[model samples]
Target: MNGIRKALRDGLVPPPPSAEPVKHRDAGVWTIPNLFTLLRFLLIIPAVISIFYIDERPWLPLTLVAVFSLTDWVDGFLARLLDQYSAIGAKFDPLADRLGLGLVVIALAWEGLLPWWAIVIIATVDLFLLFFILLMDAHQAMRVNWIGKFRTALTMVGVVAVLAGPAFAQPVLSTIGVLCVEVGAFLHIITGVQYARLAWLGRRRFR
Candidate 1:
């Protein structure tokens, strides 16, 4: 449990008192995990372009979405499997998530696959997390927060469901996906609060 906690600290959870400070990131920025993340990023523009052709070639964007979702898991899995974790992946992976989600959601909305409120909700959640990160000076810590994984996992699943639902003519899946996204937004706020409290305690005690 403690090891799991340490591994996911990505600047959100602070170390407990007397715990050794995390140091010397052992992985390179160019590791297989990071490259998977990079692939998601590199394909974003193309994905958006494909969305425009959804009526004609829905397969294109849907295929890309599937790939994006797969990489989301693959990158994290490879990070742990290959033991190639890096500060870059810790920080940049989430950044890419937010960025990719924002742009893709916007495109989806434009294509009438999603409503505008979904876009607002996602952006709001990202902003909420960012606000606390800045407010609490969270970057000094080395571990990634495991709590965010629940939120991210739900989100990734939600996104795929949201798109796949319509493509496959399954309204139920789309509804479930939307529900997951809404729940994820709630979790975002909850985890942001947890990060704030833990970060405050960390800085106060360390000081």
Candidate 2:
């Protein structure tokens, strides 16, 4: 029990010694995990172009979305697997997620596939959380609750389903897709309230 508590307090991996130089330690900007993050960002351009300009090429954009969304998981896994976690990657990963998710939501809303309210709610929550992070200086210690993670997973699943639905001309698929989005959005709102409560508690602690 004592060993488990110590491990939890100190983290599973030991920190590098102060006297020894760590490999690829130039502030962690040039690691494999960071590379995956950069790739995710670059994917956004092709995704946007496919959605806006290439109306006839639905598969292209859908594929990009699927790949881009999946890379969110990939980058995190690589970060932990390769021991390539870095402060920059930590921040960049979530930013990439927001950017990718935002782009998809905007495109879907503009195309009249999704309701504008969904976009507004998601954007508002994201901005509020961003502000809270800045206000609390909690970037390093910030962690997403399971509910938040589940919400993200549901959102991505819905987006992919919707994209696939129209590409294949399946009304049932589109219906299912919309249902997923609705459920995901509801969860998103709940998580947003949870986050706000946490932020309030954090503020009270500082006061």
Candidate 3:
């Protein structure tokens, strides 16, 4: 007993416990790390204006959408490169992504360019996932899976292509675009299911 006591005493440091250090990331408002996000927000205004003001150039705002999607990749890369990681950035980044995609999807559907069911499916998936996230709160920090990430990229690419030309004219591209949307839809559903399962298990464990 004396030997065990001495070993623990030597091994453990008797320091007072405290909360983890709060890292206040620089606002980065003027930094390159945040430029992409700013660009994304800026794009929304033009996209809305172009959508309503000009029907002749439907594809023009899609270029903005493409730019917004591309910026998602750019911002993340720049953040990592600059080592400007922050909790605020982490929280709002995904929100920005959802805003961009959701607005486009709804707009396209409203204009009768996109099928209503497709929009419904994606929105339903998002809603279900968000519900579980709210329930799990901190217990389930919703991290994007590789499949989820890939599907999102594919969906963005598909949306851009769909806007670029007639579906029949670009046979291969259209097929791939449809495939990408379908794959994205599947991933959204699967991810939501996974989140719900995790939330349920976590609640059970906590109880």
Which candidate ranks first by lDDT, i.e. highest? 2
Q: 1-207, model 2: which lDDT tens digit per residue?
A: 664454343333334323322334334589887998999999987886677642587688789999998888777666655666676776677778777787777787787777888888777777776666555532342356667777888898888887887688776776677777777888878887876676666567657
Question: Which ranking of candidates, highest lDDT first?
Answer: 2, 1, 3
lDDT of 1 at 53: 83
Each candidate's clash count = 7, 0, 0
Global CA lDDT computed for model 1 = 0.70
Which residue segments of model 1 deviate by more than 4 Å?
Answer: 1-24, 128-147, 193-207
lDDT of 1 by residue, 1-207 (tens): 655554455323444545765554657677998889999899888988888887777567878877887787678766755578776676667667767877777787787766677567777766665554444433343233565667777877887887777678788987898788778766767775665566567557757
Arrange candidates by TM-score, descending: 2, 1, 3
Q: Which stretches of candidate 3 lie over 4 Å from their true place?
A: 1-31, 52-54, 128-142, 166-176, 195-207
Q: So what's the TM-score on candidate 3?
A: 0.68
lDDT of all predictions, in order shown? 0.70, 0.72, 0.62
lDDT of 2 at 18: 32
Q: Could you tell me every candidate's TM-score relative to the true structure?
A: 0.73, 0.77, 0.68
Which of candidates 2 and 3 reaches a greater lDDT? 2
Deviation (Å) of 39 in candidate 3: 2.2
10 residues in a row with least lDDT, candidate 2: 17-26
